[model samples]
Target: MIEPTMELGGPTGPKHRPGTLQNVVFAVRGQAAELAFRDAVQG
Candidate 1:
């Protein structure tokens, strides 16, 4: 996910541009972080 998103160079080509793909990346990472945190806490 991060690989492809980073490969696009982002939505604006060069400049900083927000897009749904970026959102998906953020959500995926966020969910992963949350799950890891929960596992750590429970363990």
Candidate 2:
């Protein structure tokens, strides 16, 4: 149940920008990887 969430600077600002979306994807992937590593270590 590890769900990664991204806040793209709220509604009405920069959320629809291509670069912003790319950044959000990268950020989410990084966070998910970090969480997975932690879970593997703990388990």
Candidate 3:
């Protein structure tokens, strides 16, 4: 799931403009951070 998205982000061509790919990356990273934070807090 995440691997494809990251791979797609490898090339910052015209299609992967500033906000487009960056937003997806940020969303994925944010979800990961939230999950990690939840785990840490639970622990």
Candidate 4:
């Protein structure tokens, strides 16, 4: 299977990209886990 590439320039005047939903969720979860671990270690 072939993947699509972002157009350098077009009628829309380039695409505005953002992080994937899964990545955003993972980042939040990871930060929460890190904070919990730190709290456990300190307290």
Candidate 5:
């Protein structure tokens, strides 16, 4: 399962490429969780 990556050119293997649909969802979920954690700690 080769996939494009930002670390280097070409599809090296399984990876989360920036701007891809999967990455977008993962980034959103991660950021949401991070913000929730921050609020829990600071607020």
Candidate 6:
């Protein structure tokens, strides 16, 4: 039930682009997995 938000690169250089959909998806999934692992460890 985790709702991830997309982060667009601002005027602070061009470290992050806005057209990489696959990267966004992978990032979210990695974050979700990390969170889940932490929760399981705590529980």
What is the C-alpha lDDT profile of model 1 across 7-29, one tens digit per residue? 34434433444555766666567
TM-scores of all candidate predictions against the true structure: 0.54, 0.53, 0.55, 0.56, 0.53, 0.57
* Local lDDT at 24 for model 5: 57
TM for candidate 6 is 0.57
Q: lDDT tens string, model 2, 1-43?
A: 6333334333433456756767666666767787788899999
Off by over 4 Å in 2: 1-19
* Inter-residue clash pairs, candidate 1: none
The positional error of residue 15 in candidate 2, measured at the CA in angstroms, is 13
- Please give the lDDT score at residue 37 for candidate 2: 84
Best by lDDT: 3
Each candidate: RMSD: 7.1, 5.4, 5.7, 12.6, 9.0, 6.9
Cα error, residue 39 of model 3, in Å, equals 0.1
Task: Give the per-residue lDDT of model 5 (tens digit) for 1-43.
Answer: 3222322333331263644776656555656666787799999
Ranking by lDDT: 3, 2, 1, 6, 5, 4
The C-alpha lDDT values of all candidates are 0.58, 0.59, 0.60, 0.47, 0.52, 0.56
Indicate the TM-score of model 1: 0.54
Each candidate's clash count = 0, 0, 0, 0, 0, 0
Q: Evaluate model 6: give its lDDT.
A: 0.56
Better of 3 and 6 by lDDT: 3
Better of 2 and 6 by lDDT: 2
Per-residue lDDT of 3-41 in model 4, one digit per residue for the tens? 111122222222343445654565566566667877999
Model 3 lDDT tens row, 1-43 = 2543344434543255656766677657766776787799999
For candidate 6, write residues 1-43 as lDDT tens digits: 5433233223321255545776656666767777798899999
- Candidate 2 clash pair list: none
